[model samples]
Target chain A: MTPASSMNAALERQPPRLMLADPILTMTGIEKSFGDVRALRGVDVTVYPGEVLGIVGESGSGKSTLLRMMNLEDMPDRGEYHLALPGQEDLNLFTLDRFSRRMLRARHIGIVYQNPHLGLRMNNTSSGNVAERLLMAGERSFAVLRARAKESLDASEFPISRMDARPSELSGGMQQRVQLAKAIALEPALLLLDEPTTGLDVSVQALVLDTLKRLQRERRITMVIVSHDLGVIRTMADRVMVMRNGDVVEQGLADQIFQDPQHEYTQQLVHAKL
Target chain B: MKLDQLTKPWEAFSYGFLDQSAKREMRRRILKAIAIPGYQVPYASREVPIARGWGTGGLQVTLTLLKPSSVVKVIDQGADDSVNASSIRKFLRRVSSARETLDTMEADVIQSRHRIPEEKLREDQILVLQVPNPEPLRPVQPDMSEARIMHGDADYGQLWLTLYEQLVRSGRIMQGSSYPSMVNGRHVMTPSPIPRWDVPKMHMAANLTILSAGREKRIHAVPPYTRVEPLVFDDVPYRIEDHADKTCYRSGVTGFFMNELPQDDGSSSFEVSDSQYGVKHIRRQEGEPVTLGETYYREGRLER
Candidate 1:
């Protein structure tokens, strides 16, 4: 069987979300515009715990913009973005003061970008890239930092020998692995990936995706992944949301959405993949 | 030039070389600087006989604090006899009529250019450091107003990124002097031009340290018993100079910051950077009635 067929088989065998808590994220009526162009128009999303929610769309579909909003990288023009984690204070992402927003982002959220350069500090060593967030979170002891960085790098299946190697010196796939290592270093509660494997070679993409899948399973982190690749969304995400022209066209379980897509855009996307 | 002509004129200048109003303004600004810990308070930097960039910042503060009975010691790059240090010392004494001493332990106020005195400063003492550049963010940011905003926002990511880049490029941090440190958990400060060896001495130190830049017209303080942490990565530890293992050739002081002197054979001999401290050690070894205060570093290691 081809890798695509194998991915479908794995998708069929995947388990359902393990728990049903209060939605970790509650965003409604989210709207964003740049000058005359509306990047998002009344987007609403509710994410439960321990579920991989994949956002798939064509270019300029506001997929990346929505992921950015989810991670608080950008503020929607009009929306109520609340984070209601277990036993934690409900954080209004838009209304928080700068310091509190920073603390919330640092402690709970992790983001991996489409390009590794945007995520990893190119000049910093692989371990330093992983430990940078830890340092910013007020971690001081070298021993503790090295041990924790080692654990994350090991989980990402990165070679321990390259711990001191800078990201600029690494290959594209290795750079992406370093980005993954850095993002998951603190074992964050929420992981947001924006076209994380889009820029890598096909073979390299497989390795990175495999590493990401293993990480998501081992950590059971709530994830919001944005990609145009249906195979990626199919093999990984439990639930899928398809977007077109700054709106979520359809959202449902991964199997139902792919097997019997309702929206024209989503059907065209699925058929194009075949 | 007749002696009688020169003797005809008698001038009355303000005490401590600064006018009453200037001193009062400085006093108010100093208090604010101390209260805010690492926040730089701008002041009207006045002119003095010394040049603007050369220990003038330290001189202004020393002049403001001096009284008839206040004992003062001054050092430049750890030397008590340097031209800048001695001139500032003499100028301070001449104007305020304060007592002058080279010994660090005997001073009420210690004005220094580049190094912290080797001896531990007491609670009664105040250290006035001459800061050439008060802004630690200046390396990453050149715009003063924007730098101020970053300071207000407690945004030090660029400064930390510089260190991170240095670690990767050089295999070690290349900041030889003027180490960037976080003061009291809020402000990232450049602790004057003191070596990395002396940066740790300011952490929760007993004495109050005021860093003033005359050219820049900014003064910031590290109040007594405040945290002064050097900006460092956790995995890449902060390392001091390798001078700990070398002994001073002149004073036989083994565990202090040192100056290297090139010899005829191309070998370098070490001497204690704190000139007066070394003299006291030599005097004590020669059976003179001398008292040596406890040093910040002992046996080539910093005492916690």
Candidate 2:
């Protein structure tokens, strides 16, 4: 093997650093309502760095809303969202203004939508889309943005040659890679994904999941992924939060959540997936 | 003319000329521009209470598109403090009480003429260029109908020929301001009055570039990463304008194109002038006594 390839192989084999000292994201008594439609009701969840936390729930269970609330995309009507920094207390994300929240999202948080199209700016090229969050964070130089974009695209296993190609020209899997490239580019502290592989084919799904796992490992990023697929959740999540009708029905280690689900909803979900 | 008869009718008719209907129509056009990305739409143009050649399009657009929180910056020729620049800046302050900025980096909405700012614009920032005309084919084909047809068919043969002729005459592309371009490689558009130096800056620019011609009643867009090529032949390629003497009196900015103001004595020697028509007098009065505090404060702030 070439020297570079051997080094890369060795790096991949090395165990990632365990930096799970404190919670990066903490949601307490989070309540959200859309004009009589209670999307979330007193949902409490915490996420730690170097950890993958899966949120599993059936349709209309408010799992998606819970994830959105964590990212500050959807503000809970009543709750304390304390986003933990390295040496700082959990910040109350809900109290901050819209602009500040958006800035925080751009700087510290990255979100991947269930539909990759929704996550990506379809009109821009792959590199442009990847560079967008960084641009929004006030990284203005074209050269710096381009270089970072190329690096991120390569890290995500996206074709660097197709960096100039727009989302419309790419396949679904390729577009998803662009979305992944965008999310991972910022090296965000918290990565919130809403059913990232819902619409993808099984073969494509496996590839995307593998890439995501590898990225999470490399970056030591804290993740909150909402998915109904128990198998995917088991594969990717270190811990699991099972929600039903906006409330977290159960929370435990991934192995425990699957092997011995305490909640009836979690059990039914597992059975249904099986 | 009897005073009683004139006074009685004047009161009723005086308020009638203050028709906000035209402003409403411009607002509708601005909305349509947002809804239909990259589609140039025409509206009933109004002569904004500002100068004709001076940022009237940008002023009208700003007036129509302003939200309460919008931070605005107006640059004429490229610098922020030119005479025409201050006039529009003052007008926006009077009309909307929107926050005004001199820093190109800080502005949420920049209304510019002749140049894009040297600073790179952010995605949230929207650039409104004051356009003399929106049709890129205007120089090549004067007929509006023919221009539209050419744009509809993507026939840019005449545009290519014009560049080819420039090459034959000057050995390089001579076209400067109002550089012709293809928006999204679909619709022919203009980059307004910015120099050829700033023309290449528009290619795949991060910010949304919007052009408005208040007199022409048209609005067009160049979405981010859109191909914005200046017409050039292979043998004689497109060249950016060079500024050997790059200097900004106030900002200490160098290597940017500066306007030359002819002295009143009719001397051939040209003094550095701001991009806008009127602000040279202020700069002259301020003189080389660089008030370091003012410069520092202005630099600290962002332009809108």
Considering every candidate listed, which one attains the maximal TM-score? 1
Please give each candidate's TM-score: 0.81, 0.54
Where does candidate 2 chain A have its weakest 10-residue lDDT segment?
Answer: A1-10
Best by DockQ: 1
For each prediction in turn, the share of the native Cα contacts (below 8 Å between chains A and B) that it retains comes to 0.39, 0.00
Each model's Cα RMSD: 7.2, 17.5
Evaluate residue B88 in candidate 2 and report its C-alpha lDDT on the 0 to 100 scale. Answer: 84
Q: A90-110 in candidate 1: lDDT tens per residue?
A: 756898876767777877889
Task: For candidate 2, give the docking quality class from DockQ.
Answer: incorrect
Q: Top lDDT: which candidate number?
A: 1
Candidate 1 residue spans exceeding 4 A from truth = A1-22, A268-274, B1-22, B42-53, B67-71, B90-100, B135-188, B200-206, B225-247, B252-254, B280-304
**lDDT for model 2:** 0.71
What TM-score number comes out for model 2? 0.54
